[model samples]
Target: MAEPDWDRMMQAAQAGDADSYRRLLGEVGAWLRRYYHRRLPPAMVDDAVQDTLLAVHEKRHTYDPARPFGAWLGAIARYKWIDRLRAMKSHPSVELDENLPVPGHEEAVSSAVSLERLLAELKPAQADVIRLVKLQGFSIMEASHRTGQTMSLVKVNIHRGLARLSAMIRSRNDAG
Candidate 1:
């Protein structure tokens, strides 16, 4: 079958055409289902589609008639897909194998201790910025606020600190 003119349907829907709006929603739902099913797990596909549909409904007023409908729909669907991924990451539903060995935290702790020891070799300002912006994943501006330093200073400290750390590693390697 030929594809319907989604832009025209959406324009009609915007103009208070109830039947056209219903048809448009039905067609969009089908398209969204196909779109999500290919990317998400089977169990999550339906929820993703429904979430996209609701977003489309809520943001229908923002859709420009001059723009292609598919582009707008795709953008919303992509955002919803990313949201689903983030949610999954934050609360994974994977079943752990009982027979699988769980690694100890000793390696992680040792690495952290080694990193702190290396950071200590740098100036206090440089070490603070590197810890805040790199290790703790804060933005430069946030690090600046936390350290009472300007944004530019935070960036400079990070750059210098990393260079120093790299040189320290190289020197140790050459000596050993």
Candidate 2:
């Protein structure tokens, strides 16, 4: 029947009163859940509420005692809700792992071992260049830095290494 004393609760909370702080956060969280439910999907309401509450907890020190607590809380909640909406729009959820890649595992190890053996067939410099750039995902600049080679030399090694690897694979395929 009475309006909740938000300012008093918030002031008490700011003064280090644990019970009031807990009560304020609980009430705010409940209110935010209801507010979010009207605007967001059911699954998203709880997440928004939790995020808003966490922001409030983290930014509590910024609260000015003279200001209306509801306004401050509303500002935080509004931003959080908007952020959630933006995230939802930007990253629409997909039912991932419901269906696995399920690739054939029969030759997985043999393929890896075979690839390693193929690399080993090249000169060590060529093998190292290919492994650094192609296999290990290092940038050309990084590979050059790691191997103490110049940028031009790194490029040359990568080109030569790839050509050699292609010939090796082709020879293997032709023989097999």
Best by lDDT: 1
Candidate 2 lDDT at 90 equals: 32
lDDT of 1 by residue, 81-113 (tens): 657644543332323224223442343344356
The models' CA-based lDDT, in order, is: 0.69, 0.64
TM-score of each: 0.52, 0.50
lDDT of 2 by residue, 54-153 (tens): 8998899888988777767766765665575345323323122221224423233343455577678887877786667654557778988999988788
| Candidate 1 TM-score, C-alpha based | 0.52
Lowest lDDT 10-residue stretch of candidate 1 = 92-101
Which residue runs of candidate 2 sit more than 4 Å off their true CA positions? 1-4, 94-176
Q: What is the C-alpha RMSD of each candidate to the true structure, in Å?
A: 16.2, 21.0
